[model samples]
Target: MPVPVGVIEQRDDGPLRRGPRAPAWRRGAAALCAGALPALAFPAPSWWWCAYVALVPWLLLAGSAPTRGRAALDGWLGGAGYMVAVHHWLFGSVHVFIVVLGGLLGLLWAPWGVLVRSLLGGADGPPGAGRSAAALAVVPSAWLLVEIVRSWQGLGGPWGVLGASQWQVVPALRLASVGGVWLVSLAVVAVNVAVALVIVSAASRLTATVALVLGAVATGSVWAWAPLPAESGAAPRIAVVQPGIVSRAPGSPQLRFARSEELTRQVADGRADLVVWGESSVTHSLATHPSLGRRLTALSRTLGADVLVNIDAPDTDARGRHGIFKRSTLVGPGGPTGVTYDKMRLVPLGEYVPARRLLGWVTSVGRAAGQDRVAGRRQVVMTVPRRDGGSLRVGPLICFESAFPDMSRNLANDGAQVLVVQSSTATFQDTWAPAQHASLGALRAAETGRPVVHATLTGVSAVFGPHGERVGRELPTARSASAVYEVPLAQGATLYDRFGDWAVYVAVAVVAAFCAWRGLRRTPGARGGLLRRPLSAPPVPPAHTVHGSPARPGR
Candidate 1:
């Protein structure tokens, strides 16, 4: 008969056996799947509730890993899975390089994985209540640190922030008004940690349950107690024109421009205070193309309102250097109003290759930009004449700029009454990218207490109220149309806008305090504080029973 692992067999010579370990491949695949699960919480599937538990599988795997090295590997694989899943749509444009980028970015999570294992299990079997409680704060703080590091514009920006998954949840939006998406992400990760402790550590079950209850209470408190934005009493009808997909043949710019003009004329109804076009609506710079300027001026005169158009064209600076700029220009009855905001943040590889001299070869791969686009020096808030004889301050964000929360908050701080994001996802019309891009406006609006207008060239143009509520029907990709949204203006700032990433600061402090407490635990005299271990000595191993026993000296 075969002897089972971990069981003692009686024979001429007795020995104990241990079970064979599971293969590394199986654990890695599980980690990858667990990491990808959170992407479902974003757009398309938009399973917001799934985000609350999406990290559990990964956390459990990391926590139970036999060694710290294996746990780190788990974190890397999981982070890669998450990056690929959330950005899978880019595969259409970025091709096979998306996988490589995902792997590189996944490195940011490796330390996080090791941290999880250390706090939850380490060499000991399961964590006690003290460690379980620390995990609630430290784990989320570590996650936030990763988020903040990866949120740099060069690092693909903050496209899939975990808290953004709750854009549709009113209570979550209320929390966003309090602390921006960072706080929401912190709360979400905390809940996941608490739940994992509840499932794995019976001794820490009460502690985990208390954390969960506190998260719920805090969210509820924000919803009930946060101050509301006062209405500015200047609701303006903003018209967004989507040209849909046009031919990519020669002269495509003119084709898109003509189509946008036709749609604007059809939808304006002379009631819109301002007519807005999507990113790259004008292909030719007005300085170089007098006729294009004449046409836009005529359109503005016919609509009886100023027009906001995005220009994607090359321009020559005073220094005689020429570069392509994605600029938002305002046109009144006159040709050009000189109120312009050039796009400051460029898409990493899509708009410009970072460290171009070293990485310029990427342009030969997939669809990376051949020449880097010039960045604007400063953000501009334009004052346009509202049809009611008062001026409205408009802040314009081009394409990827809208993904940044700080930019919108800065605009609100600069006295922008309405926020407009002019974007073109024509290359990704068939994918979920358009919908995902549009969803960001709601989060931005909720964070800054300002109405946001997301105008897209191909599809998925949307408007959100000051509180992140949808203002009108979305213009999806299938239709070539225009829609006017009555966007409400608001006064006063959201706590997130006022305090600016206070949640991140608090998280940093928590992590620092925890680290200090941990460092102090090693000292002989410093172990009697709040997180005192009930029983410090390691558990004694089970006594070995020897049948008949005179052993050899070597044995």
Candidate 2:
């Protein structure tokens, strides 16, 4: 009896004895660091490579324990690290209050770890093909779900979605045409899953390697064979100005007027057919202030080109209700026709704090404090004269509005030949915000199958062609400068622009079906039997054990 009981006990603890249990805090710390690795890789541009391996340690640790609570904790740790690191630039604008914001934002990761652990199972057992398949499909879906949720009105808009990390990767960017940014994100998650499988299971090593190789091959093949929009003609010459004005400065309005004058002078003597200024170039109302309109009209005529100027000012509607219109006004060789495209998507806090009555105190400090800019309700496309005597329609996105895929797609659907983003990044100076903001234009360009010009205060101003390739010149964040480039105006629609994010909705449905199936199959007395018992369950002894002698332990 003693021998039998001892053998059972030994068998129960055998797998546990193979390795020391990692401390909760250590595992949490490792997860945090792992999540942050990819973000630190920013600025260098090569840092995106870290994304492939960054989540491995966190995944491994989550697999080690395999409990729902543990997984949530691990995910929270990792998410906190990733969000804090990537958005550290927020601190530059928000100051020490960022500590609270970072911690609050870290909450986004909790479910990620839980999902990963559930998909992988505990470290002692192998995740079978069923689990592997679910992981391959569900992980990326979960990420997209989270991104969509976080892109709400009050939460931060889509700033650093994983798909944006591959901004410079041409092949991955092509995936945007098929499924918006979700496809690229899925591909990345799939790669990470393959890598995790290879690391964990020796028998599945060859299988994992094949999966990884095939995924790469698939991505590469699509990139090489993807049908791109045909080049219509030589790109129209355009110039963008970065005046680098601080919004709160007493002389900011005057300074912007002077900079606009100078940029117009430069374009007038140059070969530019169109010139663009950053958002709020005229920080006064053009309709109410005739002098401002006169200056823009003179500039457009002097430059002999259509000049797109962003105006941030208050205007009264037909009902005489006073409201602000952050608009893009096109001044051509003719004059200002009062034709304008007001910004649709407004940045929370930065534009107008949600629940302003309750959180009004939040606006008393930091970069966006005391600002009460109103949002526009329409998605209007502004038409300007092309240098070739043809009219070029532009979809104008003000600042944070450019980050939304649907917004840009709608603009293209509205017959916009070019996507123009007028932005102000001076508040986030020298941070990844500008680069991240600039990167989205590439994705938008791909999604819409149209060239996009991002003109910003501070820098990272650039032009992306219909193929999502950077054309013309790009200015770094360190300088107050200008760039002129020819951007081809392509007419047509991309599959994504036409169809929208139907793939994402399909994926969501699939994930829902999977979760429901798993839940039903795991129900008591189901045909497939229950999932493996909890880790704390006692182990059973081998049957062919000798009496009176110590029996061998079960694996």
Candidate 3:
């Protein structure tokens, strides 16, 4: 057997692993590479399988650290890489503050790296399969905890979650039904740990192989045996109107109206049961603006179907003159239907500035759009009038709102048979943002066990079945036109919809258990396996003779 490589721990300022360690710059670069490697698994490049091994380098670096502080630095730098790579699109909008966001967000992983070093740094851990298995389980669990915490909307929302990288992976998408994205994330992290274990324990390769095999088996089993969604009702014919219009700064009112009107008419010419226009397609509301409302009313009558459009307009209530509210309203053949859904979740910097009082100084970084948009209070499940007989229950979300999982989940739970995402990604059409935004429909569909229609303004308009399989050809980004699709309706809630975020709870439990285990190890008598630190020097032997006299030097 190969000699067991000893892990060195430097309690004092000394050489690491019996030698001078590499310079801090080299180590920092390694950490950054570890963090950024996973970005390839996301959109644009979209190397989906890369997520399974993306964390290996960073994890190995953290585990090799001679001290917890060093390990934390390693993890932080790695996290900074991930944050910067995943959200680089923010650079166009947030400007230099993208660096600030990455730096701040990267801090979330420092303690995580410290924990990895503390538990699996191999100081006290014996060279055996047990340690390998523990690493395989514990590393992913800890990562799940980090992903869950980082996903909190206040930080940045769940933009490029690890599991989301597997949007195209059928097995991974199936796992999402039972545990949400957290389950898939856990599986991916475990796979990475297994790969690391195999490399670290060349002498004891069987354990590592077992871990890798088990991960594959579990993933395959989920894909083969997981529940599939059942069709709940009749299919609805949906047509998306892409005006091929680009807006840099909301140029002109008449121009916007005419464009939306002409394009919608072209698509809605009695072709489908419902017609969709991208977010803010109708700059004014039918309720407030009569001229715009009259034209839509005539169009709806001519089409003999319901016309759905988004409106961003100011509303005056009893409280005071509040900011503009953006909502989607459905127009009936006769006139305006009161059925409407307001966007619940608002974009942080794009829609409104957060902490306007303290950090309001960021106006110099990006073009500051005056007046924030107000958010809606509750979920709205609109019963859209169909060309057939009974109406189809649909839950509509605006551009940025689709990113929030709860928005879709709440809609599904509230009797929404189909999920519709209306977006205008003209701002980042040329970039990866449009495709990334459109792909979220797959996850939402799998999670809620409902068909999802991602109808966008420019392009990348796609549809997914209840099980997240792509329904038809996805319209590419940066292009525009009218595309008609027959969206299938599915019934019955998945385990995720019924028991929401079970995977997150599992992650929390795993984290709590790991913390408790670490605490137990630090206790006075905790064995701590092979990494046990000597509390005091081994008892000094008395220099004595056999007859109780001082022993000689040879004795």
Candidate 4:
């Protein structure tokens, strides 16, 4: 029936507002698939190109969500998939609790999903180039924020960031220098958004395509044109000792030390300026094992080089408290310089349980310690007096710390010409963990413009230049005891080391603009996109009818 003249009619568009919402099961399935996509971009699988489109599945789901609440759920589910897939090996360490951990950390991306859908208009907002551009900028910034938050050691530390997915991509590593991994992360997310728009934005495909092209060109130009730092004065011949082993279960520090010392003997001729051992190379404490300490001293004197060994042992304070510490100590021909760098950022289940009383019940594949490895106060660079001449500074990052970009950057900024990662990936050798662990050194080298000596126990020992270029062939997961490589120093600093994460500034600006735009468009009972609540929130009742009369309650 037709409405009478002067009477108004409401237009109902489609089932989206109230139709049987996408089934809970389908939504969940999509989320899991989308979330796990990024994992293929990481190690073991090592499909680096996959990262370019990994988030597309999740982004598409979120951009079309019926309500802000549903979008958040989708995002959360996807985030959960991502967490579980990337850190699935944690099951070996934390056992069944990995599920709970993924769920908890997945909360980090719930708000992000909602934001993406809101910018895509979710079920109600109009789609246009303006909105698309805004989404592209804000979504990536939001991702960075999420990464930064979840990166806290309490959560899991910053293990598998989206940018680190590009650890082997030279250009991406170049991007790391200026913005750190966060910057590369930002770029990756932005590219994903642009790619999404090509399929979704019908009216503005040309604009989306142009934006995509420009983004690609700009990233390429920055990488291709960037200048490589000059080679500095000295090229030191350094020997890295990796006492390869199959398992560390029955492995005592003494046994590991003996194996390392033997390997050092093979490589540490007068030709070597320094001999560096992998983490826990010296299982005994110098204070407790004076004999072993004397042996190291004698070895250094005989080789005419400085010895840097990692001591994983107990240090009892005057308070009579016992604590285990993993430290990198420098001992010379004369004696110990007393300069040591302790492992600051430790692995959650591997090194220490976060909450021992509550969660300690969940044990790792490796035995959980009664006490965690104590954290170091700060970053230290050990200066070794070159046997031939002037002194060369070496910065230390313990096993897990190499996975964090900021730690390496800190050491480089502090005048470390050579960055050494003393690591033990024996736990996950059969898995892709060893290769993935070894690859992280490339980004560190590129970001800091310093040579990285990635010495390890078990396998995958490698070296890289200031630009992340390989200095020599890497030893894979095997029993290769030692390798010697001459690393040339790169002079000066990359814009990244000098400037810090400039990408964060871009993220901050985008976020601020998004917030401001949301605030200005506020309507009665209608909050802007950023603050939109889920379908669970009570819908606002109409204040007045089109006829200008107050509408009835519950109408």
Candidate 5:
């Protein structure tokens, strides 16, 4: 029954066989779970270290895919999972619609998945150093493009940027100052790529190791040698008033206004330089409701400091159209300072339904804005007098605008001394939304080298110093109180403020250069006439007859 030592065996049923593949549903679930892993690295958990390796599982799953199509599917499902996980708190407001948005946005990752398969998922074996090197540069660049596209205001401004997870890390903050969040994001993705390569193939370990070392060296060099924000020796005491969630009845805005007034009165006279109230702290416009103006003037005189408050009320624009506008108005002792900044970037569904004619029915499903809020024309930096006879330049952002780095950077460049963000997450106060919203202030502060006051109505109000460090104790959702921060002013412009998103430009160049290189590699040689074969060339043989006698001229 034994076969000869040198004999070969063949089967009619099949040529070769490998292990059975995982089912589609199982693969999708794995990708989803892998994608969600990065959310834990953000606030509430604040496991900042987890972010460094959070994308590993997703990368592994995509790299080992049996086909390029399967890898693309994994990428899309994983992206959807990431979006849902990071913005899970929106479920209380948008319900199932958030998943729909997530799926639509997840499409951006399909090409990235295919790119991963092409570069790393070789059937022969683990990729060589050449492919791994290309993966290192190209993969992260592709990821950055995805982030940039999704950051549009319609899609959801930059709410949960991966670099933002490093808001609390000092070295990462330094990198942010140099290149804004884009650089930090680039570094983070590159590290993930290097780690994935090291884990998948022994041949790539050397390249991955080199990348890791170079990354560490670059980070260290920037931290040690980068220009830091110089201390201006002026510490302004900024007080933030947060009145925890009030009633939601018909007269709730009036009740919330009264609560905020009560908290403002609790602060001792002359102890604060500036008092800030949360967004929508005043329900009506001061021009129409002069009584509200008088109340704010009384508080300003009592505290011997100007009061900054947000107004959400109906107003007739120059075009005679009536709409609600969220405005940040500054109140001094004389009454209204006549200085205000209307919120330019309105929250997508929360403020207005995009393409209202088609999607207006969403209002029936949840608490989406019945009417779209009007957007402002430009940004404003108001001048306020300090207690020491000096003046302060204050830049104001209403709620969602704080998530945008360019707004704050532009304000700082335009000579704003301190950036104030008035926010209210009353709808999802009990969830992680409040904390996640608060964390953005730190990133903005680090990027602009200006202290950020993230004063909120419901809870989790916080302040970050110029270096992205917490300035004072945070006022949590359960507390209805006023806290003052002795925020230090920093001088000199950050590299990010001067250069403005240079990291993004560099990334674009890298991607473009890589594309050009690939195209050049595939082009026909200059000496060759054309890429196609000529009819004069010998005809190709069939796979079954490769080893048979060679064909003669006409055989």
Candidate 6:
């Protein structure tokens, strides 16, 4: 007979075998899980496999650890692996900063390991149905908390969040309507837990498997049953211009400008109501350069569509401090609207470094030239008149600004019929950044119940309908391409749009309560009136202390 590695040794009198080796299948299972986790981060337009399998290794390792501490360590290792693999793209944008950022972000998973170990009872306890169900709730809840904490402004990069891995999974996406992205994240985690349980134990495997299937069915049913709002009959045909400038390297500015002009000219003759350019399409300010403005005016007239252009311009506020603004300018039809929306939510270091005065001397730490950029005061929804004489209100979000849910919601709530995100991902080209950035538009669409048209300078520029469905086609990143998409004016609003993050608040409270309950239960003397005072309280010190020691220390 084969010896079991993990099984405890038994004496001649005991019912169980002694010093047996752990089952070979269990160790093989764990190894398989560890190897499969890295790939979970990127799934082509279909990532449901990640939702079903990502947690298996953690589950298997948790089962192998004989003590709570060991289980915690195993979980932490899995978490670190998952985070580092998924966020590998961060290195491309901030290569030097990656080590510092990755380490700080990796800490977010440390507690997750501890929590999972405690919830599952050191992996050695009876793997009963009740325990399995509890695992489902606890694991997902832990993940949701980590995501919420990391998504905050300063803690970590929220890019490639686990929920985003399910971008193509329509059923999982329905959860976004209830609690933004966190709910979807929760559902994915829950499914993973259920799947892990079914794989580990045979006695209750059927039950666990059935439960997992039911959960998925429930998700799909929600998506199918959820009432989709009516879309307005008016459809605006918009052309997105991607003037692919592979390198934003210094000295290539003129080349980039020329390329932008060429692509704009190519699409100027299309049936576009409005020609939209990606962020930084115009490197110079149109207001300051009448020559550029005239050129844009001429393009609008020739194309017979209003040209919406984004320019990185210098603006001086009341204090006479010049700051760079990723400004969006509307030119065409009615002539120079002079209306511009400055980009908010700037990328740290990429756009402007934080604490620049102290860090500016570091050579790589200075703000992008033309002074530090100031964020826009509000979301700007510009009304662009269609060639058919009808006007379509477009909410303009610039580059990194599109990642924020509330920012997009504010625009839609303020009567933006279509959300337009003009972005330039040239700096972080060929990485997951473009694909990850593109995924945000779908969530934004789900949140506001509106279609979002994202036009990027490089690639992954695409359009999404009200229900977060992809429309027309997506352009590849880092290439010169133009796509015309007929986007519908969606009517009605999502529950999340109306209620905002209230559900998140409720979830936080619930998790907090559970943590508090667990903490209290773990305290000595809290259960069965077992008031076990420390064998004897430490001897009280004398009334007065003398110099380094108490007067009656020995007494």
Every model's TM-score: 0.91, 0.88, 0.90, 0.89, 0.91, 0.82
Question: Model 2: which ten-residue window has the lowest total lDDT?
Answer: 6-15
Local distance difference test, each candidate: 0.87, 0.74, 0.77, 0.81, 0.86, 0.70
Q: Let me know the TM-score candidate 4 reaches against the reference structure.
A: 0.89
Whichever of 1 and 4 has more lDDT, that candidate is 1
| Clash list (residue pairs), candidate 5 | none
Task: Estimate, for each residue in 1-555, the C-alpha lDDT of model 4 and write its tens digit.
Answer: 444555433222111443345678988888988998999998888999989898988998988876667788988999999998988876676666778889889988999988888776564554688888787789999999999889887788887889988988878988887778898999899888877877786854666788888987987888776666788786998888877773456765557777777888887553788898877777778898799889999889888898888888887533354688898899998888788877888888778887788877766334555568887778888888886788899999999889777788888889899999989877677876788788888888888899999988877889998888888788777765677788989988887888877778878888988888777765446333333333333446558889999988888
Q: Going through the candidates in order, what is the number of backbone clashes in each? A: 1, 1, 3, 3, 0, 14
Global lDDT of model 2 = 0.74
The reply for model 4, stretches above 4 Å from the true place, is: 1-22, 224-227, 246-252, 316-322, 364-366, 525-555
Evaluated against the true structure, the overall lDDT of model 6 is 0.70
Clashes counted in candidate 4 amount to 3
What tens digits encode model 6's per-residue C-alpha lDDT throughout 1-555? 343665544321112334555774565445334634744555333455755676766766665555545555555555555665665666655555555555556567667766665555442344677667666766777777777777764444366567766666566556776567777777777777676776666754765787778886877777776655578877899998887864557867667666766777787557789888888887776657778888778778888888888888776533455778788889985466777787767766666656778755433532233246776666688998887888899999888777677787788789898999999877667666788788888887887788899998777799998878999878977468777888987787777778887646766776687788665645365344322222333455447655666466566
Expressed as tens digits, the lDDT of each residue in 1-555 for candidate 5 is 333455332222111124456688999999989988889988888888888899988988888776667788999999999999999998878889999988998888887887777677734347899989998999888888888999999998887788888888999999999999989998898899899999988999999999999999999999888887887977999899998877878998889899998889887553888999999898888889999999999989989999999999997644565779898999999999888888999999999999999999888888899989999889999999998999899999999999889999999999998999999998897888888889999999999999999999988899999889998799998988998889899999899999999888888888888878766654366235222222233445543435675555654
Q: With candidate 4 superimposed using the best TM-score fit, by how many Å does residue 324's alpha carbon deviate from the native?
A: 1.5
lDDT of 3: 0.77
What's the C-alpha lDDT at position 70 in model 1?
A: 78
- lDDT computed for candidate 1: 0.87
Give candidate 6's TM-score: 0.82
Stronger candidate by lDDT (1 vs 6): 1
Residue 348, candidate 4: Cα error in Å is: 2.0
The superposed Cα distance between candidate 4 and the true structure at residue 66, in angstroms, equals 1.6
Which one wins by lDDT: 4 or 6?
A: 4
